[model samples]
Target: MIHAATVQACLAFALLACVSVAYGKPTGQASGRNPSKAALDADQQFDKGSGIAIHKLDGAQIENLLTLGKVWGFLKYYDPTVTSGQRQWDYELFRVLPAILEAPDRASANAVLVRWIDGLGPVPRCSPCAQLDRHDLQLHPDLGWIADTRLLGKTLSRKLQRIHGQRRVGTQFYVALAPGVGYPVFKHEPSYDDIHFPDAGFQLLALFRYWNIIEYWYPDRDVIGEDWDKVLAAFIPRLALARDSATYQLQMMALIAEIHDTHANLRSSLDVRPPVGHCHLPVRLRFVQHQAVVTGIDGTPPNTSMLEVGDVIAKLDGRPPPALAREWAPYYAGSNEAVRLRDIATYMTRGPCDEVPLTVRRGDHELRLKVSRVPLPKDYLAMGDYLAIAFHDLPGPAFRLLSPEVAYLKLSAAKASKATEYIKQAAATKGLIIDARNYPSEFMVFALGSLLVDRPTLFARFTVGDLSNPGAFRWAPPLMLEPKAPHYHGRVVILVDEVTQSRAEYTAMAFRAVPGALVVGSTTAGADGSASRVTLPGGLFTIISGVGVFYPDRRPTQRVGIVPDVVVEPTMAAIRDGRDPVLEEALRLILGPTLPISSIEGMYRSQSP
Candidate 1:
């Protein structure tokens, strides 16, 4: 998953603050062995590193390690001893990794792995082992690697195959599901935060742990946009040979980004990864038609002399936006290119410098200027307020009557208790616009969506991981929204953009199921499921989309996002004119183009907050 790239100057870091957003009892608890001496030793030595060091790996060594990682991960989930929590898998990896690395050939390495599996004690034959029926499965356990005799050799391959046939089922120590929500929950993964720069063995453990989590536990792994097999092999060397703390963290960031899930990110210090700086330009930037366009400024009465709205930024600190985006893309975790660029734009103006030079295209002429930067407060409390004041532009009441015929509802501040009241008010209007461009204060999927439907309507279906089967996935029942009174008979428009993510995207899906409800805007942040925490070595944490979200008909929404029925993106001309093009388009569809754009421009400015 790691790609070597040439570093560009001032191509510093942007903190990827992805939201850290969480499952059961096993039936076969009586059959498994007690915790082993090795596990106890690992628990006692919790604060120490693996003490393994490797400066580099040749091609053959890399291949052997790749196979070892697969087998080790397979055992971690599949073998009764490891899955029963009797073996400390992380430390077990540490114990075996040095031997695997030193083995001169694949046969010798496989022998080391075989002996390692044998040491776990004989896997008691499961009386009734779990079987793959494939009747209602959305995904089957990807265990083809276990059957590759040529790669794994006859002995190791057969050993893994036998274990697969008797794989542990139910009541796993490593993973489980939430009681009500079916999303996967990882258990007992140590953060190892004490080790600032984990040694070679711990570093490899981190990669193997995360990769296997996605390989087995992630429901959306099928759509990660790459051969997941290749990713493991590619990153083995990168992580095993990580020389320092920054290098280890940056490589982990790149590894997480490969999933292309906006929910996936380095939950720890993201400042270590490049375009590294805290200072940001006074104006907010958004990519319009693939070009960085100035959309809004920070101040109440913003300064427009230096950088006006709709000005296209051709250069930032002498580097073009596209080139800069390329350099920073690997570190920016996103579901799709739209969402990726959306986050990249958020920190495009950020760097270590106090003044950022820019070349702006104003009208037909290029104007070169230097804009002063504001350093965000290091304190999270003040940073939240600063970011709100600077980057966030949604400021108004949760629900408001925009005009005699139209009503506006901003979910950013919406309360569930007022859902009926808002619907009652909007009942008299000809159209209602539900602004989902920002994260909702409350989960309004049923509270708000039910008010727009006439009957119980199926909106979404989820694919959840099976603990017994690990990598296997099966469809849960489709979620439906029951009809509620005061149902607004008026047309509905749900506004969304890249900022719309997770619960926001899920809410849009529910609202879009209404008879005449229309989604208007560009693509949204495609990460739609609840995020599960994956603790790694070096005291690091990352997340993955724990479940698969799809439409009633089984259409995917993980990375594709909620598709808009009427796509409307802000143009340079429209943005400079102080207009909301997406909202205007919704009004046109509802008001039949009778009202002028100027009349719809500031409708929310006078609304109650």
Candidate 2:
């Protein structure tokens, strides 16, 4: 039925297709027109036998590579069979990047991806594959690029759909489901060998890995206040153009800061240790009311007479303190501007010189002083023994009766088991004061909260990522504090400040579940949820709020922190005078001023009887 000429032409076309695939070349290319010239040149420059120099990529090349990375990471996580237990999927990404980079045009790049996808064998059907765990409530709706049908095509799309079907769900990126019986365990260790700076491949790998994680799993991405996709695009050129180790590290720090999370901070590398230079001022500074205030001085000799406590720092080396804080903010990570400025004030004392010229305001006088920068002492960073002090007067044990009818519990040193004993002791008390002004020595959310409520209460909820559906989040089961027998039916008051964070915030939430529990004081530190460490190239380490934490009603706790029912901020005068206004307010709320001495004495007598 077919002619001899037709058969010959078809055979010739088939042979050309095979040759093109083998050589990674575009089909029907003219002899002189090399579509892959720029890409090939880039590949040649980067591939120097040891590793690819990711920093050497040009703007166009970097864009292409980022696109490739996005698609590659999506498949790596969604399609488990891509690695096939032979090598790590991240390493596989590094392996295939060069081929993609060698494709000069979009069509050629897509062709390269198609070839790579083809080589991934088949998407295996795993009936017992774990369903995605969703524990945090942060959401990112912009990650549609992961499953864009135009990029993935029918075959890969159908494969993903088939995998979804195995889970009894329709094709969706983020799936909603019930909490699993157990938590999913993850290896916190690094999966790659350590490499120094200027190793562009490792740098790119770190950036891509972290970006994908945040893109797919980070719950509070929406609150980040920046276009994360644009951030990724902008950083590609910046990371690629990083000239040295210090610059690269700064770039990485800046990148981490974009999340606007206090938990997100880069651990110092050997070359990048803080106070950022060879020397630092002996004084610790705190940002208060937008002014840099000297808080404490480490016993380094030269500057004790020059700088004093309560002095306001106006300038650093002729630059305004506010401007300096702005300049240095990108180097520090915090949940909000207040925390960022606070951290900046602390770290801004360091410089390359032996002495830093400072302008400080003492009362009404502005004085310029040359403060010597000394090596920070080993114990300089320690939080002093003040937290061990019992709150207010009534203090035999951490938990005691402030008044006969009022119970005071200092959570900083109290244990979980102690909560049970304290509840029994304070059972008949009319009011309970929980001082969470410091970090807890032990977790007491259930142990303490259970004895406060008469019924099971929803304390908080978590929003976690669905790995199968990257960039999607679903609320986990509400965390409830089940009531214990002999529950204390008393009004409760909890204290909080910036010092209260993470477990403290969580504990506050649990206690806040009690009926008529009043949260007093200013906002707590906004960084809540379990921390997940991220290791980068050059042995740099960092952490982030690995989960989303929220009130049962879905009010976000991250960045926003725990808002007080009655907002109260400690005054500068109060700190200087050693006044416990927050605690005083708690006492006022519990014991009215009109209560007579006879009544108080009668209440104490009743307790003894």
Candidate 3:
């Protein structure tokens, strides 16, 4: 039987913050740690070992997948010699990998990777395993530095590539890495199966995760504080509870948070997607000073009040993090930021019961307001982009209002919700206008291909992972030629602005493969192909990479964005009012075959993603 006292005591010591919700935080006080003497000594030992001057793990092949610099950092922290008993698997670099990393017959060496990771049954057919097989493997540019264990990790990954079938929830699947060959043994259950690095051991994973960037952060941390460890290990009782699935998702997102890089991290999947649907508020809010400040309202009762930004949060009703995590504490506590900051995220993203009551504090008075809840419009559900596709908030058309016959739809974020029904509404229209102003996810363009493809034609395709090393291969999804519904049999014009980047460029490139699609506007934000998200220790999170998109032809549309078929720019004067010269030209092209009465060199023809 689980004792409540023991559970509470262990909760204090375990430092596992399990307070989790479906989605996420703020920059308040980061959860700080003061190292005990032992932890300090361990840190010293790690530092002392660094002087040993082990060669840098440099290799083009594995760098793309493992990022050698990062892998070495993590390994040094875990320091394989350290051991964790509870862990199901461990890693040994030399015995497991020396031959492969040093091998000149690279293909033979690469083949070992497949053997290392492909273990057990009900595996190899899984999505991860299959995707691995399809990827272009880049051999290590610096083959000499490849660690046996890290190579083993590559091998383990190869093994994992074989698994088939899928679990119902979560994309960051779990795999168990056995210590001996450093192979992957488990496939299906990523959550229950804990992943560990034998060298770094499991004593302090946060350091490997948190300190890698060496940005504006340096904190003293201890895995086992004297008072806490003694109290928990001797006096506390053992506690085991079934993990909540939602909390685990929250935890996974937290892992993404640890890697602040925009391009590299975990993905649910590019093919299968998540629900873009979200519970929204009647009012628009901004995070001013750690408070959910109201900005605009769709004319709701509680939101009608003139609450401006810069107001401090006085109090929140049950919707606050404190209130939400009262039932599930660890997720809130385990988060990377101060606990208070998490409360703020909850206040923003989470739906409120009945009315969401808030107390915004100005100088002397505390204003109380209650806002009625509403669902966010589907098109507007994007993370950081303005929602479009006939959205009501904006003034008339972003492009030419009547680019006579041409209908343009440009967006940044593609969320899974009915608010997004606007796209269907767009694809069904006659003339086409696609504003690749600032693209978001690759899945949006590829996933939405069904909506655009009237016939089976190629979209865009590009190589994923590294394809240099002898062993490494490419991960290329099909260039979607199938349409979601019927082809919108109309003249299609796509507009791209300077901000057209990553997924935006990919979307533009996708249509370029089509016969009649024309790209206009200025250069795009270059960086394609990044289905990335970071994973934090505990439950912190972030994302990585600059782009997550690639053309079907396996060409790069990065640093240098996609070029427009028709080179038309927008002017400042035209932008001041409601004028899109490029869009106007597109409309002209659709309605009439002639070039515009306007000049060829214009500014942004339309404002879109």
Best by lDDT: 1
Indicate whether candidate 2 or candidate 3 has the larger lDDT.
Answer: 2
Candidate 3 per-residue C-alpha lDDT over 418-471 given as tens digits, one digit per residue, 9 for 90 to 100: 223544455445567666664342234444444556666655543322211111
Q: What 10-residue stretch in candidate 2 is worst by lDDT? A: 383-392
lDDT of 1 by residue, 246-326 (tens): 898899999999999987777564566567777777777888888999887776664843788889999999999999999
TM-score of each: 0.91, 0.76, 0.40
Candidate 2 ranges beyond 4 A from true positions: 1-50, 54-57, 124-143, 146-193, 268-275, 297-306, 379-407, 423-430, 592-609
Off by over 4 Å in 1: 1-46, 300-305, 379-394, 602-609
Report, for every candidate in turn, its global Cα lDDT versus the true structure.
Answer: 0.77, 0.63, 0.36
What's the C-alpha lDDT at position 285 in model 3?
A: 43
Q: After superposition, how far is residue 563 of candidate 2 from its true place, in Å?
A: 0.8
Q: Write the per-residue lDDT of candidate 2 for residues 479-516, one digit (tens) a residue.
A: 77777776888889998876676667778888998999
How many clashes (backbone N, Cα, C below 3 Å) per candidate? Answer: 11, 8, 109
